[model samples]
Target: MLGELWGTGNLFRLALPDTFLGYFLLLIDIIFLAAILLHFSRKTSFNSIFEKWQWVLGLSLAGFITSQLLPIPLPFTNQSLTPFSVFPLLLAASFLNPLAVLIVGAATGLGQSLGQTNQLFDVFHFAFTGLLAALLLQQPFIGRLYHFLRHPIVSGSISMILPAFLLGLSTLVISEAGFSLAALDQSLYTSNNALLLFLFEGFINGVLVLIILKWLPNLRPRQTLIPSPTQRSLRRQLIGNFLAFSIFITIVVMAVVFNLSISVSRRLVLNQMAHNAAIASSELPDFQSELERLVDAFDNTTLFTSSNPVEAEVSLEQIYNSSLLYNQLIVVNKELTISAQYAPGEPEKLQLSEEEKLALNAVFTTNDRKIVTKNSSSVEGLSFIVPVMDDGETVVAVIGRVTQLSINNLIVGIQGVTTDGVGFIVNEEGQVIAHPDPTMLNAYWQDEENGRSLSIETNGIKNGAYQFYESKSNTRQLVYYLQEDHDHKWTVVVSTPYAVVLDLSLDIGRPLLIILLVVVIASFIQLTYQSQGITEPITEMVTASKTMAAGGNWTPSIHAQRDDEIGQLSQAFSQMQRSMKKRLNDLSLLLNVSSDVSTNIDL
Candidate 1:
């Protein structure tokens, strides 16, 4: 929305209205896809995009790599691939490189802005966030962040707030000073109204990147997978106390939530795909009518309708136009006379070899209607057909060929597959069309249940349901099914894991999981520090007690600052010291009493 406001007379066409938005967005999407494809191609051909310290770059590289190898082709072009921008920065911080972390953040924000829009501030919004992340990684005062994630303000209000304000300031100031398009920074700040929101989201993003960074090291084939778990000589035990029950309950609760999420995601995918399939299927009749109309026009203009050789060949040449999307649309008779409505880029000479001529003539004579596909080195199209016939039942001339739909759309719609999870598509053949797990499409994917394919009409179960099926890989697949008919019949299956389906209600699990992890780490650290505080006081008290018992004059010293359990120890130490002094005096008195008594009693 902000882009449109700034894009008024903008060069990148960013600020387009809805009517023209799709076109502009499409152009942007294509450019984005192209940039990704180029990136992927360069990485696959050259070397690993991974860097040891540059974790974000490695991940962006990995995401790009995965996208490159994803086998999900584009809608119009078969030669292209998609790159998801989320991974690289995730890799950057996760693996411990502050610089890469920043770079990844910048790249993702920049990529998002570029692909989805032409807005300048949008690019910098991402860039600014990334830059600050790098700065924060080294900031000396940001320790309390490592403490707990429940609140964002504790880790220095300035550290948390100032960066965001500056990011907005930079965008507005820079745009006003240099680019005309950058002045649109209002949306960025306004959306994240609170400083807490900014820091919480930003820091969480940073930590998320860190966690992903943790996993990437293991994923990297070149790097050693085993973590040399820091000799953290600490064997942790979940203590059997009040806390134990809470921990168990948390696990069970999470398990239930996970199961629920999977179920919901499955239902949503099925419902969506089924709706799309119904619409596509319904539109087929209209599409067919349009094709028929075009075919009728081509037939009347060409002389092949009369079976005249010379007239049909020469006259049809005049019937061709430059506006058509095809190079040629031809009507041929049994006599080999071709009346063709060729398009603008067509060669001047409309010549055909005997077999080529006969093949065309035979299609008119025999099949009544035949569809042939030929992608010449110069031109691209499929030979789509609806034969034009005469009243005598004998095929006189042919019309209706050459379609507008692209090959990539054909492959995806015709052969595309979705599974029981998000963004997954499965084809009629039960092959993985699109899935979150890359290996689900590949034969080697883990979880044997995932790789298995369930035939649609199985065990007398018809189509359309949230149902369970099995695959060749012995994986059980939960899928919502739909059939898509574009140029041909194809299955449009929407599926996610039953777990993912259920997870819709619990999308917060991501942040929660992060919070839980941070809590566990913080708890461990707190336990360590608390134990240290206790150890010194306890040790001093023990020493003082032992020294007094052995007849040594030991001064009492138990260091405890607070009036808690340790303070009680300090008070006890003082009492013990006084008691030791009194005991010494009593011993001396007893010696005198014994000496006097011994002399007197003997007389």
Candidate 2:
């Protein structure tokens, strides 16, 4: 927590290094190029060899403009593209070639830079998504993913996620490059604290892009190219999406499960601190009760007074030997003279605190006074004071023990219960008061230096107060705390960074992820088949249609056998050819008859 509290941290990037940045942007370009060369090579006129390029330019400009002008901005939010990007990319991807997409992607990247987070790191997403969709939509397998996921919007918005992830990863990599240690951490997101951010963005943007892609069919230029998301395609899309999603989700489950395992290191430390804190906290009440009982025992003793001068003074040695719970006892006359003193040590050498002396004086200042006080020992133990009374209702000397707040026995008991994870207690100021970590007592209440202490002022600790803070310095540790005003109302916090306590989600998620992965793979494979085989025929028909246009009359050259997309293309081509030929022949016959009749009937 040495960093700023209110905003994003080193997660922010100052500048981008080109070597990494280049790959991200280049990917977009290549995808664009593929779309242009393979799908929609622009053709203008017999002489304008490069007229198609104009569409590319138009789309690029459109992308730039939309990115710059996207109307809304989300909070603490990092976005790769804008809501307006949908409108333009939609228009461009639907109408322009791959080349246009690549160029447009560049423009979109630029726009997002200007209008969005603007960090050099932020552009990776802008570049990624722009290129990803451009290249990926051109892919049969990926396209199949689009269909199976039941998310066309994903196709539409993949532009947002890829770049966002790229940006996030880029920012993380670049910022962390110099630190050899952090790079070695197995928990990438945990070490970086960006796992949730990336996963969330990926999921949400994934869904959006999926939805948009799904919607593209009705909006495409070639109605033939867009297949109906009929039951079959839908089913395949569902399966593919399920599988891809499942893989990542499984990873997530693993993280959660691993997060809870105390064996990992951090959770173990936190639990110990919490347990110790609890012991120290709970011990105060027990000590208080003991002191109160002693006070009562002495208060009821109407044996001696200042006037009687403790007429029945008992021997100090006898009193000391007779008492089992007390370490020492003293009997004093009203003249402030000690008549007898029992000794755990040399009674003549025993001393009391100023506060304790004052409490005693308060009892002496008035008649029949009784007082209880606690004192801190400079070396060991605490001190308690209670004034004795006489039958005449007169005040006598005050006496009590010094070791009142010890928790050695309590700590031992707590340690026995400390099984998988340890627990401890933190004082109001985040100090490690009583810890399984013996070295921890009286320490500050922070996982990181100054963090807990600093926060205590802002976060007051009342009776039964609880809080948690992850160590920024130690990423794996989670400080779990429960403040219970149990008797003493101490803040009993249990720190368990491990998920063993709340990891039922992993149990549920593991199987779900597996099932999802299997389904997604199946769907993706099916989509690949559909694009390569089912839709291949239609694509071929398109090729044939081009060949027909290149030739003279349009004839049924398309040949397909299946009843799927390709077969439909062949049948359509055949029908169009028949209709055109019939019309052509009829026109020729009518023209010939008219010409002959005109000559024969010439006036």
Candidate 3:
């Protein structure tokens, strides 16, 4: 989402650029805009240009304001429904020419990008949708067809559907969800709520346009007409509207609840990981204390400053035999030369390598305990170096414990790391000193050859979480790491596969889905029962009217029993039928009386 600006050494360095490609692309965009202007300038007349520009700029500003400040957040997804923002561009396409439409679209896109910090590609999405709308509404054949269907609602709704589809498709293409059905399905399952949001926005925008046109009749396009409602069955209309609104509400509610459940579950998992990291970090001081205690035992002995190598070796062997913590123990004199050494298998004295001697010299110079990994010699593992002093002033020798496996055991024994998770320790140099996988021991943590390259600051960060791709498992992992700033200066990292988080979310979502299903079923049944009450009386009236139209005697049988609107209608129908029958009988009687008088006159 970060926008790259072009910097120095570029042909057109507009700002402090992050990359040459971004600015070069900007230059190309400028050129393209100039070309579009040139093409439109000749075809578009300057007459009423100020009036047209007013509409373009005004609508663009409205669109920007609505997009930034008035977006309606949708439930169940991270997307906000911004149908109001699309209204202005759509209005432009309806009233103004294509040139104005394009300009307004571009300006609105720019403003939205500035407000939201969206990627540059999103601007194209807005512009393209606008152009599609313009073409649909302005092209001769389509425009005629649209006008032929004079109903404003139909025209507005149909105009929006294609543009909405284009916008959704563009969104999918620009994102990780390429041009694939499976990817789109996965995106809908995950976080891309926009796919449904766009389509919903289209229908909502259509209704919005209808309302606007009704309020401002002058804004309605020429040759377009709003027709009166047809005399359809009111019962059917009532039931249909009720069902539609109920279904819409049900979907929105379900989506919101499901997404909230997933979000809560994910947060719980993150919290658990953090708690585990804290617990693991709390145990580190104990490991450090154990190392300090081992060194303290040597400090209290005369083996460090003893001149006889045989005596020093005997003492070192005894200590090593008593404690299985270390594989090798050695004493180094002031010259950084090994004075005594002990290993379980090696009976003779072993000469120290130059690298080992330098390491010991560092410990002697610093006069402090240091933890290091020694891979330069056969006694490779984590080493603990302790400095020895004569009378607390002059340095005599240094004692070292090599191949201490206690730290490894401590890491492997840490609780709460799930079966699909791993916990390990890495030193300040980003070397994995202790890991469950022995092959990864002493391997550079950032080396791709070890499976994948990790770019985390293991030493600098105190505690944090990272999501990274683990090539070994070929899956994404969420890693929580804690750094302990002791003599060892090591980082403890615990990682669990991201799939586990999704699985947890699914476990939480299942119950929410069941609840939604039950609610929807209950609502449907209730609505069906309520609707029959309204429809049944209307159906009886419709049947009576049909009988009267066919010249049969018909009466409102239930008019006297009820006082609601249906009863009133039936009462009016019954009175009109009686009056007509009385008028017909009187006229027939008058005609017979006239006929008898004419017969008497003739006699």
Candidate 4:
């Protein structure tokens, strides 16, 4: 056993600090002092206290015998189970007073420890267990629990199950703590097998207790021993009404504040998004101009001027290496044949797609730069097509750079503005050209099924608008869009969900509600305590006055501690009682004299 205490150095070994141990001992001392005070104040007779002792002691002795004679052995650990020892503690806690319960617990722990290893640690273990169990099973809490269990409409299974479950939880704590304290082998204390055994034992003990209490109905708590205060005064009623009114007003104020805050927050978020969109619009044109200049310079090189595929290949590699943006740079000849491909190992004479061919024709015919986007199922992304003009101002070779617009990366500044804010770019054709979600790319701006569109034409707006769109998931999104008029004719879209904004409002409201609840509870407790100071004295005076009025030779004096209005009333009542007693005496004396004169006359 000594070796087990120090061996293996298992993880379960609790390195409790000395200061914590000192504080724990001090707390226990305080609790014991409190219990003593409580016990003496109640002041039950010695015989009654002794009778309780006898019952508890006998139950402890019985449990001791059972544990020793036929000890239940546990698997996976060298520990004997003695759940029966809990019976005395439970019994003492149920019907006996607090002091009696403690005594029973101490005795039972001592008896069990002595019978087993005679270890001081074992005694403390059982004693601590008893203390916790007794504390949980005391007075008002137990009374309330009993009432809940025995309600008229409650089912039998429910009544039994609830109590049993609660008992199991309490027993689990005791068992775990007891094992930790008594365990010399830390490995055994931390083992899964040990935990399972303790759980089983706790559950079994709880079920057994329920069965025992059921058979011995006397052990169960029937009703509350302490009487509840019943007197209600006008002041008390007013206080209650005022508290209710305050709570109602607080709730209404919070609701109004929440609505106002959400409105302001939503407007601010929309304004921020609009600001971000404008910034992106200004910045994107600069990026477009820079890219177009690069493409034009590359077109003027010997690579495209000489129409040499070999030279163009080398020049395209240099241009692709210049920026991180370009995925591929292609040089198309006057015949619309791919002269050279920069993105590695492609044939020199690749045929252009019908959409690309059409875009090439428009670039030559219009003699202006055109951004052509492919919204086909197989193809996506943008192509910037610029006409390479000869000295005679005729369109020669067309220079186009194939690149996907990454709105997710470009619009990263708007991410922290709102939790659910999103930004995307749409082309003139009303196809989603650039979006954070890859699945939405090349998909039409209008939902085919819902007929929801982002364009002003579909929404019946001239330039810009904020429209509500319900997705396939039935979630409503607040979309704010503005058209970019710089060479691309693309629309910049920023959106967020209405629910997310509302949740933000609720987030602020929840803490306020909690604060209100805490304040109300604290106020009620304080007011109740304060009310007692005034009401108790008044109640005493009223009772005493009633007794005096009923022909009893008694004086009413509250002897109020405070020098308030209640104290003055108490003093006046005392004076009135003295005066009334004197008058009654005078009347009695007169009656006696009259009676004596009548007797003389009769004689």
Candidate 5:
């Protein structure tokens, strides 16, 4: 309490270096005030201003002593507790007028300053805590607090929590700011422990204040002239508190619901996008099977066995014309030279390039198919080569075809539908194989670009979704991807601008907003009904009362129809007005009788 700060681990300590001097000064102040209080003990007038000062001073002194002697340790902190010393000062402020509160604050601040290193300015910071509490007590909202405290259900719990929160809030702000200004090395507490400690302290002190208020009714703050304790309405207090709490809860619920809606929307969109991408990728043809069919056809043909080149060329042309696998077909001899060829507006016979010859040799020796890619300025094509056996083991000829491959063919169904959305595919070689924009085909991208990239491997693409900023488009996009299952050679990706996903969230939000609007309208209508009920009759009664007081022959128009407090008040007012009128009439009659008697005596 008095000797320790809140935090631990090199961060918590009393600010004053000279602990002995600080405690000594604090003790001397307490002793001095105590001595003065004892010396002045006499049969003084109970309600005198002098007596009030003595009480305030005595309370401050007791607070200082309490802070030193009965410090309660907080649960989570080491030697950290609020010096309930400050609580007595709060008690003084609560039970006294502004001038008395100010005096008590000064005395309390002086006593607290002794324990602080910044003796000169710490007094003001300590004084501010009481000052702020005093100000809050004077506010109209506090009238509701008083009524709320009177209720048993909340009295035990809220009375402690509310004051704890307020006092802790002020204490934290002042302590931190003061320490910062003094350039002291200290921490308030570990994380939120300080708040917890303050809360505990407030709970204890709140119980103390309640006890005092229950037993010592005379110590309560004197009521002010405007809307004082006598004028405070229980209904108004309850309604006001309900309105404030309801609004707070509504705002919190709205925020929670909004976040949950957006989260659900985002999750649904991602799942749908990924599903669509998987379907698109599944539609891709099995290139390996297509190549195998072409190989089987050439192996069964008798054209390759013909000795005449003319016959072989004619037969190859017919085969190529009928086939769906290739755009061009070439028959290579054992020497890896093209003996026969079939193509559109091209050479009938062509020489194999060094890479093609190696592929041809590989096909012949292994008796297996070989695939090679042709990349040129004109077109991108794939060639498949298979050994053509004459009978059992003789590799008489090799059949090869160059098929033009289009990346756009991979994603054909959906295009140009979404302005800010695109679907594309990446091959194992880290190249964009299939894209909405044909120009991106065969273009290689770095592993990481603009904060996103495809998962690439040597054999094929490893599918996964990712996000990135498209610099040219200047937008953030949500991406979903899936790799083709047949060969795992290409990954299909669907990307849409992030705003599109947010728009999906708005779809759900619009209805909620409308519902909130409807609720607000309903609340407004109810508030109007309730407010009118309170204000109208009060206004009429006030007018009638003023008229009667001014000697006007105004009859009370306020009806006591409802079986409620206001109705009862109206009936009471009417009864009182009638009584006043009857008394006035009786006094007038007596005055008339006296004047007549006096006249008769004079005659």
Candidate 6:
């Protein structure tokens, strides 16, 4: 079966699974397994049924068949809860040597490969797990300890769960899946469910093995008497418990402090962004109102009444050159033709597209001031349109001003935004009108490449803070936005990288961490010094007891100087040792007298 599975080409699929790293890892696993097989073959003898080729092959086949055929789907995950197919391999660990266990493991992997492809790491993971179980069971002390406990649950859990857990952990470390508290949490509780599934399978397999051992006692491995546990000194127990408690408390306190600091820092950053956003929102309308006033003033000029393009052009030029805010100033007559236009430095004829002409005509017909924002490949800016009227009744022409740099300057000049942060204006349609980067101008704010939408729902909210991942920089950003009601509704946004907040939190935590380190070190030193006062007398008593047991003098040389329990105990121990020596001396004298009396009687 193993040869057939291997011949199916599934086992060799791992040789090149998408990357050179996969190939390298496959080679390493193969070499390590081969080395284990070679080393164990020399050291292990095939004297047991578990080591027989027939039993190993049969168990391997069973494991593969059960795993492939029977799998129960786990709730809320793609993972399947399967029968513990590796039960036989774990059972074999108890009775056979590591070599036999590894053989079965490899055969099982071969069979699994026929059914599942690209599980090269899994094959070695199972093999190493079995090897570990076998090595552990083969130890005399551990085997005897398991026998002494005699509880199938305890025995099964130890032999099966421990090795499986260790092997799974090693696999995690070696695989692309990282080994950290965060990674483990994500794997167990989030999308990656491998770790939890592995442990669940191990536990089920352990129980199954325990049941089989009970049903077939003859198949169980022989065990010896478990040695008694050595007693620990009072001083050792007290010191160990004290240190463990201290460390545990320290960890708990540090975790609390760290979490609190992070929470507070994040809140402060959010609040700051919100405040800055509000200020920008207020400033936006004020700037827009000023532009509207300027356009209105330009509309009341006499340049629109004149038909001569040169005089109108000269007047527009003076107005355009007066302020850096206007990119271009134009005058359109009732026919929607650009009569005159002026731009900085070089004068060019203004050509209006049909769409732009219709938009300007609408303002002329309405005879009202209107704000029109343009966002396109060739042009990107806002156009403020105010109608020029004849004798305060009929609309004659429209005077308009196009400005891009003014709004960009307004957003860039907003105070309280950090140098690394960004401030931008998004129109009602979610299109960015002004930004620090010219390339980003006119881009959709919600576009994935620009800035993906926030994960949280912001419905019915006018102003608030939120967070979203910025794909451009691959960093999370803390964003605060406020909707401004001006000539056109606009959303002013201020954002900074979330890492800055984390750095601030870290700055806050640094002192706490240093204090924790110092406290731990001081506690350790103090405990060592204080424990010596209690442990030294007990250590001497233990040594004296050992000497007395070996037929040497038992008196302990301990100075009972301190007025404490340990000192009193030391004094008591010394008195007891002296009494024991005197009794021994009396016994020796009595024996000498008896020997002399017997000699005299014989004479």
TM-score rank, highest first? 6, 3, 4, 5, 2, 1
> Across residues 419-497, which tens digit of lDDT does each residue of candidate 2 receive?
5445555544565545555455555554433223212222343422222333343322234444555465345544433
Indicate the residue-level lDDT of 90 in model 2. Answer: 41
Ranking by lDDT: 6, 3, 5, 4, 2, 1
Q: How accurate is candidate 1 locally (lDDT)?
A: 0.44
Q: In model 4, state the lDDT of residue 122.
A: 33
Per-residue lDDT value at 263 in model 1: 52
What overall lDDT goes with each candidate model?
0.44, 0.48, 0.61, 0.56, 0.57, 0.63
For every model shown, what is its TM-score relative to the native structure? 0.38, 0.41, 0.54, 0.47, 0.45, 0.61
Poorly placed runs, candidate 3 (over 4 Å): 1-236, 259-285, 300-302, 305-309, 332-340, 345-362, 373-381, 391-405, 413-415, 424-502, 529-533, 539-579, 586-603
lDDT by residue (tens digit), candidate 4, 1-603: 123321121232222213433345435645755676466557755566676667766765654443233345544334455555455555555566655555665565455445543422333344445445544444342345444533211222222232223223323333322423212112222343334543454445555656677788877656555532221464566566668677887879787877786666566666776778766666667556655765556446455656567887777788778765666677776677777767654534444556677878776676666665554434335566666677644344444444555434556654545666677776677877566666676676742233234333323322343534343422345566766554456677777765555566666677877788788788877887877877788788879877877866575455776678988888878878778778877889999999999999999
Candidate 4 CA-lDDT value: 0.56
77 Cα displacement, candidate 2 (Å): 17
Cα misplacement distance, residue 94 of candidate 5 (Å): 28
Error of 5 at 191 (Å): 29
Task: For residues 107-210, write the lDDT of model 1, one tens digit per residue.
Answer: 55444444433444344344334434334433333234433321222222223354346444433343322322213323232223334444554454445455
Q: Model 3 over residues 1-603: C-alpha lDDT tens digits?
A: 122221111132112223444445445556766776677678876564566777777987776655444555544443455656567766666667666777677765654555543545335446655666665555443234446543434444555454345444434444342434333433333334455555565557656766776888787456433321221556565666667677888778777876787567556766777667666667777666656655666655466676787887787777776666677787777776677787777787766655456667776777766666555535555677777766664355444554545755667544355676788777677888676665666676642222233333344546666665544443456676677664346677777766666667667777877877787778777877866776777777677778878988645443545688766776777887777678877998999999999999999
For residues 1-603, what per-residue lDDT tens digits would candidate 5 score against the true structure? 324342122322234423443445445545644554444344223355466777777876766554334445544334445446456756765655544554565555555444422343334334444545554554433356555544222332332333334333333333432423111111212223445654565556656766677788776655542554434754465456556766877788677766787677656766667667666666655544565666667645467756676777787776676666677677787777666777777753555655567778777777766655444434334566777776554455555554444334556533432465787766656666556564565576443344454332224644555566544543456676666656556566677666655566667876887787688668866876786787677877888988988889656577858778888888888888888778888999999999999999999
RMSD of each: 19.1, 13.4, 12.0, 17.0, 17.7, 8.9
Tell me how many clashing residue pairs each candidate has: 48, 67, 5, 0, 0, 0
Displacement of the residue 268 alpha carbon in candidate 1, Å: 8.8
